[model samples]
Every structure is written in C-alpha cells, then in structure tokens.
Target chain A: MTFEVENVSKTFVSGDSDEEVIALKDINLTIETGEFVSFVGPSGCGKTTTLRIIEGFEKPTEGTVKDDGELVTGPSNQRGFIFQNYSLFPWLNVIDNVIFGLNINGKPEKESKKRAMEYLKTVGLEDFAERYPSELSGGMKQRVAIIRSLINDSKSLLMDETFSALDIQTKHKLQNQILKICKEQKKTIIFVTHDIDEAVYLSDRIVVFSRRPGMVKKIFEIKMDHPRDRQCQEFEDLVSEVIEMIGEVEED
Target chain B: MKKFRNEYTKETLILPIILIIIWYIVCDVFQLIPSFMFPGPTDVANSFVRLAVSGKLFKDVFDTLYKVLFGMLLASVVGITFGIILGWSKRLETLCKLVISILRPIPPIAWIPFSIIWFGIGIGPAVFIIFMGCVFPILISTIDGVHRTDPVLIEAAESFGASNSQMLTEVIVPSSLPYIVSGLKVAIGIALMCTISGEMIGSSSGIGYMILTSTSLFDTGSTVVGMLVIGIIGIIFDYIFTKIQERIFW
Candidate 1:
C-alpha cells in the first residue's frame, strides 16, 4: 500500500494583519509501505504542517492525500499520530491510557485490557499499569504515549518531533526503541524533526525541507544496515549532506 | 507542656478556649449584652442538649441537609448536561451567554419570592432555591473546563478516529474533571447558603428556621446552637469533597 501527497500548498491568513503567509508550497512526496521517512528542516519550515496534513488533522489548500487511492478527509484509526506533548490523559492510569484508542473504537474490555498489558510489558512498564500520568517522569510519560499510539491497529505512524523535549540520553534510548519496534512491526513511519543527526540515524530516507513556505530541497536515501552508527563515516557524510541542504536554503 | 504545645491537640485548642473564656467573662460575668441577647457558652451548650433531647436539632439539621443534597444532585445533572452541550456548540453557547449572565448575578435569596410563588413554601421552594444557586457555577466551570482542554489532547484523540460523542465522553469530560470538581466545590457553598435562606424565608422546619425562630423568641442560646450546626456541616462537606477530588484527580 502506497500513501501519496500531490501538489499540496497551505496558506495561513493572519486574522489581525490579514496577511496571507504561505506555510507550504507545491509539496509532492510519496511514502511507500514499511518505509521510515524523516522530514528535517529549520523552524517554520512547515515539516509539522506537512505531517499534520497527512494525518488529516489539517486540510491542504491545494492537494489531495490518498491512502491506497482513498481520499483522506479527517482523522482515522488507520494512521496513528504520536504527539510531542505526551498526550496521555491525566485522569486515566497508565494501562487505561494505552488502551484508550481501543476503548473509543468499541473494543471489549477484556480484549483491550489484554492488548494494553502486552504493549505495556513490551515497554517494560507493566509494573506501572496503575500509575497516573502525574506520577511518571517526562521520559516515562512519552514512552506511554508511544505505546498508546502503537497498541492500536494503525498501519502507519505520524510522529511530530516527539523526542525533542526529552533529555539526550532518553532521546537516544527512545530512538533506538522506536527503530527496533518499527522494524519488527514493519510499520510505515513518517517522522518530522529539526534535529538532522536524529533524522540521519533513524530514517530509511531523509527529506530535507527549505525554511519558510517549505519546499522539498532534497531527498537522500540512507542505504545503511540496521543499528546505524553515528560514528560511521557514511553516517557522518549523510548528516553533513542533510545539514548542507538546510544551510543552503538559509543563505537564500 | 512543651510536648503538648508541639502537638496540634494543644495548639488547636488554645485560641478557641481563650475566645470562649473571654466570651464568658464579657457576656456572663459583666452582663454586657444581656443573657437574652448573647448567651454564655454554658447556656448555648444547655440549649444544644435541650434541642437534641426534644429531637428538634436532629430533625431540623436533617431537613436542611436533605434539601441541600437533593438540590445539589439536581444542579449537578442539569449543570453538567447544559455545560457539555453549550460548551460543545459555539452558536448555542453564545446565545445562552446573555441569559446566563443576567440570571447568575441574582442571588438565590433574591429568588425566594418567586420560588415561594412557584413551588410554594417548605422543601420544594428550598430545593428550588438551592438548585438555582448551585447550577450556574457548576455550568460555567464545566464549560470553561471543556473549552480549555489541551489542544494537543484533542488532536491526539481525533487522530485515532474518536467520534464526536467519544470525544465528549472519553476526552472532554475526563480532561475537564479538575475544573468540574472545582466548580462543584464552589457550588456546594452556594447550595448550602441558598438552602438556609430558603428555609428561613418560607419553611417551618430546618436549621435556618430554627435560628430565625429562636432569634424572634429571644432564645439566643438556641440560635447559637443552630449557627454552630450549619458551620460544622459546611466544614464536613468541604472535607469530604476535597478527599474525593484528591482520589480522582491525583
């Protein structure tokens, strides 16, 4: 199954100024099944805007998003979204938070709870099944958020700078965990990040975006093996290549 | 003495005991306000015992308590329902805002005449007054809670295919719980005040009626007893509400 974006453009009109700001321009990209694609660019580059457009959280002004030839209009269960803010409900315990998607979809309690338990166990958080969001640390909360999104039957995941708020150690650890899980599940992941090194380490192909009214600068295919090492010469070269694309856009 | 002072047992009693002693000296010993106007602590305690034995204290207290609880329960149902609906629908909410603004400012006591004319005396009017008093605070709070719900949470839930009803039940309501609880806390105070005011204005039985009747009869001791009961009940409700909020929110 291939997901496609064709000739997408987004224009935001400022209410006070009545100034029309073009956030994205004529964007075209295709995400094949089971591929890890990362969008890396500077702030206001509309990487997140592009991701949200794909998730159907925001509508494109001038293009169509098709999932296997079906028009995407609004949010659906088929595309899982992992937010940066760790969107676990403060009122729900860890287990219930993870299983919330299933609950909303009318799954039986026993089935949902069992599936929730398996996901929690996969993340080594079975012991915290009853803990509330307030009781968990930042990293732990994000971990729960990730599991919450993944426990659903979504074939594709859209993650928006999910680890930017985390400490470096935790960020690295989560990156590795996400990579391993995505590989095993063979899920299509479209990750958006401002961190070039992170994009380099995790993605199958990196799509560099220009600054404002973001357009695709370049797409580099990282033909490296699993457990990619940042210390490798090839990894360094790819990171530099992605950075140069970003830097070149800033110069103009 | 030091150990006793360190413990709350002694610290908490010190001020109340001192105030009571001063009260006894000024009113009983000096007869400053007259025993009929301001009864001593012993007289008040005696009145409390008399009312308890005669069954009036328990009866009146229970009547007031029942009205408050029943009214609050009604207010909660109506408040939360309207809150969610108005909170969800922008157009309806804007339309109702004018009416709510006009009605909410009029105290429940101010509604006594209308309530008496409509429901007429006793528990009905008292319950109506209390329900009116509590509903606005609860409604507004629920609306605020829903409106202020974290945008990220809404986006996350929507991304997973939550329908509008699912969004209400699972996301909006639960996320707005803290605000709702706070509104309930404020509403409880208003409910009690309205219940007492309604009872005082129209009812024949209730702590408020007891206090009003005792004042007219120059039974200051019984009036003091009634006041103390109301204060204690309010404290207990606040404590219980806090405990429940902590358990659910924390």
Candidate 2:
C-alpha cells in the first residue's frame, strides 16, 4: 500500500498544566508499497509519533494520512503494530496468542490454529506453542509478537523500537530475520528507532527527524545490496552520517 | 502423605498442635477455665460426634453452604456485568461513584432490618445479606482490573480490527481476570461473615443458628464445634481460590 503523510503536525497538552509541547511540525512523506523505511532521530523527536499517526493510534493535530488515496481514519487489520513491550497476552499461550487476531476477525478456529502452528514452526517456536509469554525469553516473545501480526496478513507493519530492549546478539538475529521475512512476503514496513546501525542495516530508505517540534531533517537511500555487510566501510560511513545528523539535532 | 511432610506443612502444623495441647491441659487436666465458658478438647470432640450422628451438622453445613454459594453467584453475575460497563465507560463510573461510596461503607449487618422487611426471616434475608457483603469487593475489583488493562494491549487489539464486544471479551476481560479473582478472594471472607451474622439474627437453621442456640442452651462444646466447622470451610474456600489465582496469573 502507498502511504502519504500530508503536512502532519502534533501538539500535546500536559494533563495538569496548560503548557503545550509541539512534537511534530509540518511532517510530509510518502512510502511506496513493499518498501522498508526507518525513522531515526534523537529523544523527543516525532519518530514514534509519526509511526503512531500512520497506524491510526494517534491523530495528527494538523494533517491526515492517506493510504492509497483513501483517508486513514483509524486502526485497521491492514496495518499491524508491534509495541515496545507487554504486547502479548500473558494469559494466552504462544499459539493462542498468535491466533488472537484471526480469532477476533472470525476466522475458522481449526484453520486459524493450523496456520498459527505453521507460523510458529517457521520461527522455530513450534515446541513452545503451549508455553505462556512469561516462559519465553525476550527474543522469543518478540518473535511470537512478530508472527502474531504477520499471520493476520497486514499490508504494512509498524514497529516502535521493538528490538531496543533485547541484547545485541538477539537484536541482530531478529533484524536479519525481519529483513528476510519482509522480503519473502513483500510486506511494507515502517520502523521507528534511535539506533543508527539498525536503521542503516535494515531500511531501504531512512528518514531522519530533528529534535522536538520534529521535522523531517533528511532522507537517505541505502544502495547496498541485501545481506549488507555490517563491518564494511560503506555501512560504517552511512551509520556515521546518520549519527552526525542525530547529533546535530541533539545539539540544537 | 509426602505432600504433608513438606516444610510448609510441618511449620503450619506446629502452631495448631501446640495450641490444641495447651487447650487440652488448661481445660481438661488442670480445670483452669470453667467448662461452661470453654469446653475441653474431649468435650468438643464428643459434641462433634453427637451432632454428626444426629445428622443436624450435615443439614446446618449444607444450609450455610447453599446461602453462601447462591449469594456469591448472584453477586458475581451482577457485579461483573456492572463492573465491566462502569469500567468501560468513564461517564457511568463517575455517575455511580457517589452512590457506591455511600453504600459501600455501610456494614452488611446494618442491612439486616431492611433484609428482614423485604424478604422476611429465612434463607432469603441471609442470601441478601451475603450479596450485600460480597458485591462491592467483586465490583470494585473488576473495575480496577479493567482500568489497569494495558493500553498497549488495547491498541494492539484495535489495530487488528477488533470490534467493541470482541475487545471487551478478548482483551479486557482476560487481562482483568487477575484483579477479579483477587476481588473474589476478598469477597469470600465477607460472604462467610455475612452468612453467619445473617443466620444468627434471622434464620432458624445453619451453623450460625446452631451456634446461637447452643450458646443459649449453655452447650459450649457444641458451639465450639460450630465455630470450628466455619473455620474449616473458610480454609477450604481460601485454598481453592488461591489455586485459581495461581492458574490465572500464569
């Protein structure tokens, strides 16, 4: 699906105070179908806010998002969101959690379970189908969370720092796995994170945001081939370039 | 047998055994306390056997059990339904807050007069009293549980195209279960207290009635037996609820 964020801006009023915080300002962008995009910026930047607006979790104060020329009014199954934590239902076991969306949408129970099991098997979590979220490691839980969305056939996946809480090794493995999955499925992905290396490694295009009253500072296209080498000079240079942009925002 | 030999079981048994031995010595061996005020262990045991043989104990136990369970069932249905609605809607919760606060503080025993006038002195009054005592805790807990449901989870559900009812049943209810169960735990104790107090004042049957009549007749041994039976039932209910809590939280 093609997404157009037309001149979006967000303002937040503190609950007890009259002070207003401008989070985003005149943000405009377009994402092509099946393209992998990343939004990176310093803290208080509107990276997460932009992603939430696109997902229809939050509405922009002064703009609208159009998905394929249709107004995006609210959250739909067409766009799936993965939160930073507590995304899985603790009461549900792995396979059950995976099938939750399908069940809600009124898919056949037998078929839903069968499809959920297949997805779990693909992630090497088939043996853990009966286990609860609390029993799974952080990485494992994230894997389940990812599959939970993917199995619903969402056209675009919105991820908000979904791998930031994991250890380095688990994060790298998941990043690689997500890349493979998106490519194989040809799914559109919009990722929000502060990690520059991750943005350069996974994104086809990276949109950098300025510090709050966040505006789109720059957009970089990574021309590196798939399975890009993290140790290569070209990867390091792009990472540095993105880091410099964020550092400049932080300074301002 | 092995389960009973665990550290927790052994520690728990030590205090009760010591208390029983001290009671046996004071009441039976030394005659330190009058039998009328406090019966000896053998006297209570004899009274227990007599009541059991007469089948009155079984009848009284069943009567109290029926009142407690039935009252709780009614309370659960009403409380959960209202709780979900109130919790889901801020306007409703705010509208009912003042009335709920006023009613919640009034003791269940205080409702005895109204209960008698409304239902008369029988199982109906007893059940009403139990419902009064239990409903608030369950209702409040369910409300708190729903309020505490993670927004992230709700967002996730909404993004998946969950309708209002599906959101309530699938995300809200299950997430709030831990809170509701805890509320039920607190309510069970209140339910038992209401049952006994209601039966003592209004009913002609139940363990509460048995205790009241035995005390009036100066049959302290039988009264002690009645109290012990209530205690045992409380312990059993608590054990069952604790097991349920553990299973739900996982």
Candidate 3:
C-alpha cells in the first residue's frame, strides 16, 4: 500500500484584482506504506502546501493524490495533522484538548477520555492530562498536539514543521520517540521542515523542493538503518549532500 | 506567605479611597458648604434611617430593582443572540453595520418621548427605556469579542469535523466570554441609569420619583438622601454584577 500523487499544482488569488499566486507546481511523488518522508525547502517553497493538498485541506488546481487506492477529498479520519505552532486549544484543559478530535467527530466523551489518556500515556504526558495547554512548555505542548492527532489512529500523519519550535536537544528527543512510536505502530508520516540535518536524520527519504511556486527538485532515499548513528559516515555524507542541494536551490 | 503582591488589586482600591477621603474632608471637616447645602455622610445616613423607618425607602428600592432587572434580562437575551449571529455570519454582519450606525447614536433617554407615546407613563415604558439603554453596549462588545477569536482555531476545529452548530456552541461562545462579561458590567451601569431616569420622568414609585417629589417640596435634606440612596444602590448592584462576572468568566 502506498500514497501516490501525479501532476499536482495549486494557485491562490492574492486580491480583489485577482493577482494569481502559485503555491505549488507540477509535483509527482509516492510513499510506501509506513514510510517516513520529509520535505525540505526554503520558506514559501510549498512544502506545507504540498502536505495540505495531500491532507485535502486544499484542492490542487491540477492532478490528483491517491491514497492506498482512492482519491483524496476534504479532510478525513485517515489523515491527521500536527501543526508547527502546537495548535492545542488554549482554553481547553489537556485531557479535553487531547480528546478534541473525538468530541468533534462525535465520539462519546467517556470512551474518548479513555483513548485520550492512553494516547497521552504513549507520549509520556498522562500526568499532564488535566493541565491547560498554556501551562505546558513548548516541547510538552508539541507532544500534546501530536498525541491529540494520534488519538484518532489515523492512517497517515501530516506534520508541518512539527519539531521546528523545539530546541535542538528537545527536537532529537521527541523525534526519536516519534520514530519509535510510528515504527511500532506501522504509521505512515509525511513531515515538512527546513532543517537539512533533521530531514536526513528521521526520514526514510527526503524530498527537496525548489523555491516559490515550488516543484520537486529531487528525492533522496536514505539507506541508514533505524535508530540511526548520527556520526556514521553515510548519515553525515547524506546530511552534507542534502544541505548542499538546498543551498544551491535557495541561491537560485 | 512569601508570594509576590498583586499590584493590580492594590491599584483598584486607591481611587475609591482617595475619593472618599476627599468627599469627607470637603463636606465634614473643612466645612466648605453649609450643612443644608452639602450634608456630610452622617446626615445622609440619618436620612436613610428616617426613610427606612417610614418603610417608603424599601418600596422605592424594590420598584427600581424590579424595573432594572426585568429590562436587563430582556436586553441580555436579545443582545447575545443578535451579537452571535452578527459575529458568526459575514453577510449578516455587513448588513448590521448600517442599522447599528442608525440606532447607536440615539441615547436611551432620548427615546423617552417615543417610549411614552408607545407604552404610556408607567413601569412598561420605564423598562423599555432601560432595555434600550443596556442592549447596544452588550451587543457591540459581544460581537467584537466573537470577531476577535483566532482564525487558526476555527480551521483546526473544522479539520477535526466540527459542524457549524458545534463550532458556535463550543468554540465561539466560550472564546467571546471575557468581552461579554465586560460588556455586561457596562450594561448594568446603563441599566441602573435608565431605570432611575425613566422613573423620574414617567413612574410613580421609585427612588427617582421620591427625589423629584422631595425636590418639588424643597426638602433639601430628603433630596440629598434620595440621591445618596440611588448612588449606594447603584454601587451594590454593580458590586454584585462584578462578582457574578468573575465567577462565570475565569
């Protein structure tokens, strides 16, 4: 089972006069089941736009995205989104925030609470289940935001700069934990970020994007094994290589 | 025991205490005005005791409370409903601007003539005037609050499958609560002002009517007492509203 896209493009109108802004351009990609893919690009290079299209938050002006076997429509339970800003509802306490998807999607509050606690435990935040989102640190809030999405057990996870708000140390810690969880659960994830080293580190493959009205610049398959040794020559070489590719693209 | 002091709570008390001291020193200690012209706090209290003994003060206070509470209740229900609809629906909001512009400038007291014409000189007209006074402040602030909610929240909830009704019930209303509380606080003051004003012009048994009759008879001491009664009652009701607001909001 794989998710595939063919010739997808999206354009938005800027104003009343209808000045067109192309956010994404002719894109083609595929991800094998349970694969973790990272899209690395400069700001406004359409990495987030591409993920939004795949998640059905926006419709492509051209082409189609097929998941397993069907076309993408408006957001479905099959897709889960984790925002960079950790969009946990600030007014809601942690348990209520975690169970938000369940409540909004019509799950009974009692059952949703049970599943929410289990998911929060998976993120090691069961103790914070009753605290408000504002009471959490940035890293902890991000974890809660992630678990909120994960609680639904969606078929695919769409992460838009998921760990960018975190410091390097917290980033690595959360990334490792997330990798382990996704691997154990066999969950496919498509993440967007600008960090080249991070892209090479966590992703099964990295999709490099060109600047504005972004098109797929290149796709690199990382041969590194799970629980990757960051010091390994192969991992370092891929990181340097991807960094250089991004540098050249940004300069152009 | 060692927690930091709340500077804000202390600041709120400074103005009231300063005003009280100034009022006392000017009227009582300094003797700037004659006792009959500017009675001291003791004189006001004596008048209160005299009126209470006669049992007329209670009836006047009760009549004022009944009118203000009933009118304010009507305003709260209608104001919140319209405010939510205006805030939530773009087309409705656009349409409302013209109507709001027309209705907002006319003061509730200014509508006294029309209210009297429509409902006559009684509690009905008096209550209608209070409702008119309170509704705009509540509605405008509530709409402002609803419009200020983060758009990202709406998008996130929509992504998670919140329907329009669920979004309004769960997201929009709760988010606008602080503004609504502040609005209601302002509305309470306006409600008190309108109820007294309506009674002065139209009603037969309120503190405002008592103030009118005392002034007509030139009982300056009783007139001072009537004014004091209205001011003290206004403060009490405002204090109660603030307590309710704090309980509901945070």
Which one wins on lDDT? 2
Question: Tens-digit lDDT track for model 3 on A1-252?
Answer: 668989999898998878998888899998888899999977888998899888888899999999888998776767888888847777789999888888888889999999888878876789998888766899899988888888877778889999988888878888887798789888999999988788888999899999878989999998788888889899889989998888888999
Give the per-residue lDDT of model 1 (tens digit) for A1-252: 658999999999989999999999999999988899999887888999999999999999999998767899988899999998758888889999998888888889898999888888876789999999988988889989999999896989999989888889878888988898788888899999988999989999998889778899889998899788889999999888889888888887
Compared with the true structure, what per-residue lDDT tens digits does model 2 show for residues B90-135? 9999999999999999999999999999999789999999999999
TM-score of chain A of each: 0.96, 0.96, 0.93
Q: Could you report the DockQ of all the candidates, in the order they appear?
A: 0.69, 0.79, 0.39
Candidate 2 segments whose C-alpha is farther than 4 A from its true place:
B1-8
Candidate 3 per-residue C-alpha lDDT over B31-106 given as tens digits, one digit per residue, 9 for 90 to 100: 7877656666666677778889999889888998899899999999989889999998889989889988899878
Best by DockQ, which number?
Answer: 2
Lowest summed-lDDT stretch of 10 residues in model 3 chain B? Answer: B1-10
Instruction: Provide the TM-score for each candidate, comma-separated.
Output: 0.95, 0.96, 0.88
**What is the docking quality class of candidate 3?**
acceptable
The list of candidate 3 runs beyond 4 A from truth reads A15-18, A66-73, B1-38, B229-250
lDDT (Cα, 0-100) at A204 in candidate 3: 92
Name the weakest run of 10 consecutive residues (lDDT summed) in model 2 chain B: B1-10
Interface RMSD of 3: 2.4
Q: What's the CA error at residue A107 for candidate 2, in Å?
A: 1.5
Q: Which lDDT tens digits does candidate 1 get at residues B65-136? A: 999999999999999999989998999999999999999998888888988899877799999999999999
Q: Where does candidate 1 clash, by residue pair?
A: none
Native contacts conserved, per model? 0.83, 0.89, 0.32
